[model samples]
Target: MIKTQQLVKNFVSYKKKPGIMGSIESLWKREAVTKNAVERFDLEIPSGQIVGLLGPNGAGKTTLMKMFTGIIVPSSGEVEVLGHKPFDRDKDFRRKIALVMGQKSQLWWDIPAMDSLHLIKAYYEISDADFKERVELMAELLNVEELLHIHVRRLSLGERMKLELMASLLHKPEILFLDEPTIGLDLIAQDAIRDFIKSYHAKYKPTVILTSHYMQDVQALCSRLVLIMGGKKSFDGPIGEFERLLGSDKIVSFNFSSEPSRDFFNAFQPKWSDNGLQVEIAISKEELCPFCAKVLEQFEVSDFQTEKLPIERIMKELMMRPELLNDR
Candidate 1:
């Protein structure tokens, strides 16, 4: 279980003046701009629940995770994980949760992942029998059993990530804090990691807080989500609630049974141009079926399908919108 109240992180940024003379002068008079990575935030994640923490860059997703994991203390407010204050950095708290950042590597570059696992076992004071069992189980689940003997630096990104997961889960923590778990990997690797995560969640039911650039990760693993737009909470609820925010900018597309004159698509803007009268439209909330029927009355409609905008595209659009900077 995890909870936060008005969780906030602020940093004082230094601004440098251009030109040699100005740069020298700036040493004594450095500009201090304050940035709120997370502000007045409140969240509660129940045990055995996987919550996707979604946001664009600088939206405080990582900051929130750091606060939750005791890597960084919140500038204000309180956070608790498994009923213990996270910033206290207690040994029990440390053993109860795991944090994995995509860009950060925890594996020893020149050593075999198995050796690293052994080191971690000693560090955690795990029994030899327990460590061996966990290592083998995690390796099999992640499909990296054969790769364990290979040096980590020689392993592929996917392999390294697999090893990372195996290493992190050695103690079988109750909470998982995954940040961009599938980032910088190919589609095949992404799917493999996603599948492993899904299967793991089903089997172990660990509390998960995942922040990923890949929307598919969220779609596959998280039924609930908390969207961080700018430094504030944009939407907090089930994944459907966050998906609803993209409803206004939905898309409707279909094929035409018969090609009609330009007048068929003249009144409305067509998002697609083709040899036939088939078209797609990126429109706001409107009766898409009736609107499509108006075109269908004159022309035949085939392969009709209505789809909302992709989650990635919608999030990018929302991130650029200034109005979303301080969301409710």
Candidate 2:
């Protein structure tokens, strides 16, 4: 449903010196610099898939989304969404897509969320009956039926976000673009939003491109990930493959009934803490079962578990050493 080839966007901005003297010199002699926000990026997304777009701040994830939505035209290259060039901003193209930014509100602050939803329905020319049906379904899915009459200004951030999501999906767009959909929300609210997104996708199968700093959001909603760093594609694959990219090592954390001697852990070189009562060991994937058995046999174990490396740690590695992606 979406395709791009060597897509690039360059942003030109001026740098000025500090102070009045610098301001005076900036009028005609300002220094201009061009930053490549997206460089030689290529991606293909098929229908009925949710792809997570992930990167650090200033890594161009947002810039790429803007290009896809036609909010800003790319400096060069090609982009097509649902068989129409996004840069053209065709009526049919706009009708088939929706973009939601957590930091920005589409709802009218002084008016009720229901009023804003009605305006969206009218703008999209959805039939009254269809609009009502869609709103009721979304409200139920998001548990926001009571908030619909609340003014946007009075609603909590989470409440307003639910309304924003409802507004975006009312048209039943073929594709949805979510940029930080759960930013600044509490854990409960975040889970609610994630569940709603999952349920909606299950029912509608709309192609979704989600960009969020919250690893939980990506983990809960996306099976595929497209990771970028410095405006270049770093990794693109299934989420499991991305996890394996970090390597075959797993972390084993355990709590013993009592503090173990340093000699007891000498063979494994475990990292111990909490007065040596808690220990964490890193072992190869191949040795996980055998090592677990050894630990259980040798120690009076109270609690034990194995975990893969966290996604946040892998992301840090990717951002610092993007060349690792070249092998992929």
Candidate 3:
């Protein structure tokens, strides 16, 4: 479990004036500017839940993660993870939490991945039997048994990522922090990582906090979502509620063998494909059945299917107009 109240992290930087004369003047009289990377943020996460933290660049998601993990101390406010203050860096607290950041590498490049995992095992003081069993189980689950003995620098990003996950989870931490776990991975690799995480969570039931730019990652793994914007909490609720922020209209796309008349499709506010043979329409929930029936009857509909409101589109809209949350 994790909890934070009025959690704030401010970064201070010196404002450097342009030109040599300004630089000379700034040595004695530099202005200190403070910016709130995360301000007055509050959150509570129960054990055994997968929560997705979402925000755009410079939106303070990482700042919060760092604070939660005690990688950086907060400027003010209180944060507790598993009944211990993270900033205290207590041994038990560190043992109970694991953080995996995709943009950063924790393994030594010069050593084989298994070697690095062994170092981790020693640092965590894991028993030999437990360490060997965890390595075998996770490598088999991630399908990376062969790559474990290879030098880390020689491994591909996907392979390295799998090994990094194995190293992080060997301790069986009570809470897991995944910062873009599938980032920079190809489609197949991304799916593999997601599936592995799902399987691991089902068995161990660790509390997971995931942050990713990919909405599909969030959709696949998280039932709850917390949206951060401008260093503030804008939305925190069920994933389904986030999807419906743009309204309950159903998105349905139709692929036609031939183009349909503009007049027939114009009433539906259809967005046409570049080739004009495909179109997507947004239909109200009440009219969805009748509209699909009518379109099927009237058009040469080779294929058609309905989908939920896309989370990507919703995120785009929310980024442009964060005030929409007030209206909701």
Clash counts for all predictions: 1, 0, 0
lDDT (10s digit) by residue, model 2, range 1-328:
9999999999999999999999999988989999999999999999999999999999999999999999999999999999998889989899999999999998999999999988999889999899989999999989999999988999999999999999999999999999999999999999999999999999999999999999889989998999988999888999988877867577789898977666756665589885878998767878889878987898889999876436766787777877777765
Task: Show the colliding residue pairs in model 1.
Answer: 257-300
The lDDT of each candidate is: 0.83, 0.90, 0.91
Name the regions of candidate 3 deviating beyond 4 angstroms: 19-22
Clashing pairs in model 2, backbone N/Cα/C closer than 3 A = none
Candidate with top TM-score is: 3
Ranking by lDDT: 3, 2, 1
User: Each prediction's TM-score against the native?
Assistant: 0.87, 0.94, 0.95
Question: Per-residue lDDT tens digits of candidate 3, residues 142-199?
Answer: 9999999899999999999998899999999999999999999999999999999999
Alpha-carbon RMSD to native, per candidate: 3.2, 1.9, 1.7
| Model 1 local distance difference test score | 0.83
> lDDT tens digits, residues 271-319, model 1?
6556765677755557566767776676677766766336666677687
Give me the runs in candidate 2 sitting further than 4 Å from their true place: 261-269, 320-328
